[model samples]
Target: MGIYSISDLAELTGVKTHTLRVWEKRYGLLTPQRTDTNIRYYLDSDLKGTHAGVKTLQQRGTNFQDSRNDCGRDGGGM
Candidate 1:
């Protein structure tokens, strides 16, 4: 149950922090936990899930925004 910060996720997943924030707000694809200090944190499961979702959508010929929206609608990957 490793908890990762946005920067950690960005480094591990190769997704920009800004883009990830957009996905969270716009698509609601990921729901990260918040610390008492108002810092965002993601669990390992969340990271893996998001990674799979992004890859699946990319393979389906969807751009980032479209993929994010589609994941929201499709429950984030197949």
Candidate 2:
């Protein structure tokens, strides 16, 4: 159970930090934990949702909302 920073997740997932933030804000793709300082941190489970892979997390459609709809609650394809 490793905790990861946004940069770490971006590096591991090959997605930019900006995009990761957008996804979290727009799509509810990630559920990062907040520290007392209000800093966001990710977990190994965040990197890999239930059964969804890293590639799945990186897949985005024209608009994030649409992609999110397709990528069910677990961020896996419907």
Candidate 3:
């Protein structure tokens, strides 16, 4: 079980820390645990899902229509 801070996840995934926070809040992508000090941290599975989700969201780019077009062309390429 890996533990990662927001900075770590951002560094690892190249998804800006602010963007990660937005995905967490706006899309419920990554569910981080908070320390008593309120610092957010993530588990391995959380990071894994967030990593995958970021890839998908980057490709989708806030538009399901574009995503569907890609899917139609590529059979839901991942």
Say which candidate scores most in TM-score.
1
lDDT of 2 by residue, 1-78 (tens): 899998888788766677677667767768799999999999988888622644453463234345655666332222
Model 2 Cα displacement at 57 (Å)? Answer: 7.6
Candidate 2 lDDT trough over 10 residues, lowest sum: 56-65
Alpha-carbon local distance difference test for all models: 0.77, 0.67, 0.71
TM values, all candidates: 0.74, 0.65, 0.69
N/CA/C clash count, model 1: 0
Displacement of residue 12 (Cα, Å) in model 1 is 1.0
lDDT of 3 by residue, 1-78 (tens): 799998998888776787677667755767899999999998889778866866776775644335536545321212
**Runs in model 2 with CA error above 4 Å?**
50-54, 57-78
Residue lDDT tens for model 1, 1-78: 899999999888877888778768866768999999989999998799778966876788876666547556432222
Per model, state how many residue pairs clash.
0, 0, 0
Order the candidates by lDDT, highest first: 1, 3, 2
Model 3 TM: 0.69
Candidates 1 and 2 compared: the better one by TM-score is: 1
